[model samples]
Each structure stands twice: as structure tokens, then as C-alpha cells.
Target: MAAFSRTASLLCKNAVRSESLGKLNNFCTSARGSKSYQLVVVGSGAGGAAIAARFSSKLGKGKVAIIEPSDAHYNQAMWTLVGGGIVKLEDTYRPMASIIPSTCDWIKDRATTFKPDTCTVSTQGGEEIKYEYLVVAVGLQLRYEDIKGLTEGLEMDPMLVSNYSAKYVTRTINAIDKFKGGQAVFTLPNTPIKCPGAPQKIMYLAESKWKKNGVKKSSTITYNTAMGVMLGAPKYAEVLRGVCEKRGIQVNFKTNLVEVNPEKKEAVFMKLETGETYVQPYDFMHVTPPMSTPTELKSSPLVNAGGFLTVDKYTLQHSQYPNVFGIGDCTDVPTPKTAAAVASQCGIVAENLAAVMKGGTLTRKYDGYTACPLVTSYNTCIMAEFAFEGVPMETFPIDQGKERQSMYWVKLHILPRVYNLMTKGWWSGPAPVRKIFHLGLSKQE
Candidate 1:
């Protein structure tokens, strides 16, 4: 713990400018109605933390304020491993106070209203914050309650669980342990989820676990996805199709989870292509629910027709408000929502937003770089890194499409370390690492 503390402190110092690395308590609890900042970040998640660190260092101390309500910040990307009993939930989070730059003001509250017309927002704490530049990184909100009987099922039966939330993740392990060889069903929802591969990742893990428990012969494993393809990338999709076939895992495409009947131990799914519905009995079920921005935030003027921030897909700047930028799952970026994408977007938002603050026009663009480690088995993974339209923008010299113990080992061991650096604003995505691996020739053209 001491070594981790020392390394984290050193990294934090290097990441945050020396001037903004002090432990000065500039945070305000005053009932003051009017407060102002050079920059006000709406959420303290990955995008907000990185962008705030970027400008706080350049702008010096006390110019940045992050609006977040949580006392603990989570690296939510690791929740899948927690569900699979690979990691503990406590290991996935850190104190928000520790991750947030000490020099910046932490307005610990939820943002209730965004008046972009005046560049002002009202918080639930009854304080109003005004900003010259704003960054919105409020991640997606899960809608587990939207599905009939789902909430009750999650509460009543430990056998029914979800990897999407911390509360239900441990139940997945419990369900696996108590399984007596029936249907071990899993599902993917219709709406955009934070990590697209997470729904099925647990399925693969459960398969391995069941095989280890000697229940593989009797248990029927199934993955029901709302999308037509196994993965958004065609190359990975082709590989995953083979995995499903070889593992004898039934995959139903264009199938959506609509309802769960906890009493009957039945799960109902709607076939998106055929407009048909079916119910299947199950001893264990893992469900991923539809996700969206909070109802109020989605309906606000800050959002586009699609209920996400109306930001340019390239620049991540608001189309309507030049001074405003969007990042993370809440934005209308045409890429799969992942922590890796947010990591790449952080630098872009910081650089481009700084340009805007200097009375300059937007120039930086995001190349849609995102990574998803498809855990095909307990000990192997296929690292899928790409930009728009499934172009093979990989980081390693070796073929990333091939499942290897090396990739899986990194997924379990190294990526969590990278995520720790990322949330603390110490590390950007592997763009530099990728360039170095490509000998500086793989410049994202």
C-alpha cells in the first residue's frame, strides 16, 4: 500500500501541474447563488477527470470545478471481472477525493439544470455555477426498472443477476456456484450500453467456470443479443461466431430482453427482426438492461434529437454551443461507448477546448479509437482495437484478432493498472504506445 501510494503520488504530481497539485481546500459549501469558473466539468468520470487535469495544470489552481455527487469513483470497465469472481468490487473503485485533483474545486452535488444559453447550471444543492467553458461527461444511466419483473427478480432470486451494476454482480458468482445444471441464460439489451462486450464476457467466463465445475455437459449456455452481429467489428464478429459454435453456446441475434418472470423462473425476449416474443425457463440468468441518459438530462436542450449531447462526432464540441464539449457515454459520438474511447476523447476535448478558450477555432478531431478485450475463455482473449468502420487500428505488432493468453493476461493484469493511471489523469490511451509499436509510422491517418 505504501509503494502504491508513493507511485500514485509521483504520477499525480507529474500529471497535474505543480501549481495545481496542492492540497488546498478551495471547495465551496457556501450557499452563494453565483459562482464562476474558467471551466466547469459536469461529471467526474473518466472524461471529466482527464479533461479537468489537462486544463487545471495549464490554467493553474482554482480555475476548474468538477460537479459530481459520488464519494467513490469506479473504474466501471472492470465490473465484468468482478461478476466472474476475477476481481473484487472494492478493488474497482477509489476515493473520489483521491482521484480528483486537489487544486480544483469539488462542488459535491448533482447538476439539475443546464442553461447553456447563459453558460450557467443550477445544482441540486441550490447553487448556481457559471463557466466560460463546459465539459459534459455524465455517463449513461441503466434502466433495469423498465423491464417488467426485472427489478423484483434481481432482488428476490440470487440466481438472477446483472454485471452492469455493482450491487448485483456478486450474485452472478453465487448463481454459478449454486447451479445444478439447467439453462444458464444471458442477454444483451437493445439500447447502447457502456461496454458492448461486457454482456457476453461474463457468459464466456461462466462457461469456463461451469466446465471447471463439471456441469458443462448438463447446462445449456445461451447468449441473446439485440444486435444482428456478434460484434460491431466484422472481423471480430466472424471470430466470435466460431467461438460460439465451438463452445456449443447458442447465440440468438436480434433478440431483446423485455420481461422477466421471477416467480415462474422464466425470461421473456422479443425477436427484433420477426416481431415475435418467446419465454424460456432458466435456473440462472444474467441480464443487461437498456441504458440512456437520465430522463431530465436527455430531454434537456443540451441534448440532440437522439437524446445525447449535440456534439460533432469529430471535434466533440457542441454543435450549438462552441464553448461546450461532450465526452464519455452521454455524448453523440458515433462509436461504441467504452472506457477506451473516453480515454482517447479526453485529450481531444482538453486540447480543443483549450483552443476555444484562447478565442480560437476547433481543430482537433477524434479518430474513433476504441478497444474491447473479448474474453473468449478464462485464460485467453482477443484484443480488438479499431476506429470507424472496423478498420484494424491495433497497438501490438502481433495480430490482435487472434486469441492469446498474452492478451487475456494483459486484460486481467495490466489494463487495470492503466485504468488506475487514466482515472488519475496520469495516462492517456495507448496511442503513443501504438505509435511506438508501429515505429511512429502508424500515424492515425
Candidate 2:
């Protein structure tokens, strides 16, 4: 009890220093009191930045306000490469001020209370702001504590790591590079998470790494996932299954991580089918913990039963409240959460919200288009693009399901450029490129 109180005190103290926690704004009386904007964005992530940049420009200066409490904005997708030693951790971030538009007012504080019915919200920095329209882009929150002993396991050893957190990502590179032998385990948790394919991506990278270091035979690689199937998309799942078979990677479906014992180098898994438990000792472990929407958003009226924003999947507008919209991991979009998905949704939200602002009808529709550059090895990747029902939507002329060096290069090179363009509202998605590549054969789905 005393420790918990001390920890809370420390958090309060540090909140003043780090923007993500909270910062007391003593400079402006208006900032602390009631203020208003034409559009208020709840996060400064990919979706929020894109919307703010696009709408703030079109609506004019001071019309849009982004409520974010982070000093440094991260291209979180790059954390995968950082985990695999393909990129440096430092290279993945930029000053939040750089991406947020000068025309848009950034609140620089964490939102504490959301009152969607009244179109008002209270921030941790003591600001009560009202908005004509609200965009909820505050992404999923990681929950390592959901699994007992998981945090300590990550803290104790470099090999005991995860790509989920910025602090733990570098350890993945370290652990993989220094791996000697024995059971190297990777796990996908039972709950909904950001980047569904990332767990296996790292597994494949580790397998490739082991083969290169001549430790392939010495190490027994295993992938344990809670889902009964590997990939959510059927066509892509089939190819991924084949990849696992070809690489001799042992996969246990319907297996979920329940606990960890870092002292024994052991992880406990419960079989979802029969309610049986088992233990596996590991030399290296990468855990993708359960993730959920932020507690504040989850408890708010903005969210649905599952604690995701109840937005129309097509128009990206709130189901009950027409003035509210959602994007990124927070929305109940029914698509895998990825930067590509978020970028594509930005276009839909911007167009529809603009139409509504002008007393116009919402016409722009999102087709659930999403892309995942599944890196199969050091030099190969399957650039899987699809829509609502696992229907393959290839951007290039060739087969997207097949592993290709060209696709790997696209993941390694082209996507970063696209992400940068999207941040500045210059790129909504690869819609135009897709149309041109498909020779005007693009379907709605």
C-alpha cells in the first residue's frame, strides 16, 4: 500500500516533466479555462496528425486543435525494424512540434474526461475545451500487468523482451544477437492488439537471424498464439502457414500466455480449448501483451460495448453522435490496426466531416483497405494488401501474396516516405497509386 502511494506520488511528480503524463500550464488563463474549436482531435498520432493537417489547412488557422501530451511523436511502425536491428531506435521519433501544424492549436495535455453528449472534455492540465466536432485517435494501451510476472520478466533479462514498448524494443535486438541456443519463444496474447501480424514477423526475423549465425539447429523456435488461426485474412493465413511449415517453426494455436517466471526462465500457457496449463522455458522471449483502449475512453460514453469508439465503419463517424468521429486503434473499425489502415481512414474522416460541417451529407466511404509488409526473412517479404473480407488488393502488378525481394524493398524504403507524406496531409493513402497500378480495376471492397 505504501509502495503504491509512493509510485503514484512519483508519477505525479514526473507528470510535470514528461508531456505524455501531464504538464500544468501556468502561462495562459484561457488554456486552463474553457476554450473552443471547430474541430478537436484527441491524439497526435498518425490519424490525428493527418486529420489536423488536412482539416486545419482547409478550415483555416485556429480552427483545429490537437489534444496530445507528447513532446516526441513516434513513427511506431519503425519499432519493428528497431527490434530486429534493421533500424536505430533514435531514428523513429521526431519532435511533436514538427508534425503538428502551426495553424492548429496543440493543447499539450492528456485528456482526462470525455463528454461526447455535450461536446466538451476536460484535460489533465485543467482545461475544459468544447468542440463542434471531435476525432478520437488515441490509440490502444498496452497491458503487461494482465499477465502475472510479465513486467518483471521483461525487466530482468535483455533476452526477455517485447517490441511493444520503446524501452523494451532495443532489448529484442540485443537478445537475438547474443542468443546462444535453446527454446526461443514468441507469443501473441489473447486480447486485441495493434499490428496483429507483428508477433510472427519477429519470429521469422529471429529464425532468419539464427540461420545466419549458424544457431538454427541449436535453437528450437516456437510461436504460440491465442487465435485458432495464424492470420485473420484467409489467403494470407494460408501463405503464412506454408512459411511456418517450410521454415520448420513449431506453432501452437489456441495457446495463450497466462504467466511468466523470469527466475525459472519459464512462461505459462493455458490451452483455450480444454482449460489445461503448460510451461515452456525459454532462452529468448518476445511477448505481445494484451492491449485495450485507454481507460478514460473505455469508460466514456464515446465507446461501444467493447470499449472501442462506436463509429460507422464506412463513414468513420460516431454511430450515436454525428459530430464525433474515430480513427486508428480506438475505433471499432473491424480491421487490423496498422499505420496503413489509419492513413486510409484519415481520407474518409476528413471528407465526411468536411461535408457535415458544410451542412452536406457524408459521402466518402472507407473500404477497410489495409496493408501489412510481412517480412519473411532478411531479404524477402509478402506485401499483403486487402479489404473487408480478406480479398487480396494488390498495389503492384505482380502477385502480392508471394514473397518477393521487391516487396521487402518497398517495406524497407517506400513506406517510410508514404508515412511522412500522410503526416503532412499530402498523402491520404495509396488509392491513386492503386488505381493506376490496377489500370482502373479497383473495386469498392
Candidate 1, residues 47-139: lDDT per residue as tens digits? 888777777778878899999988988888888888888889999988989878887899999998986544567899888897767899889
Best by lDDT: 2
Candidate 2 structure quality by residue, lDDT tens digits, 328-391:
9999988889999998899899889888777578899898888888988878999888888777
TM-score of 1: 0.91
lDDT score, candidate 1, position 315: 92
- Write out the backbone clash pairs for model 1: none
lDDT of 2 at 97: 100
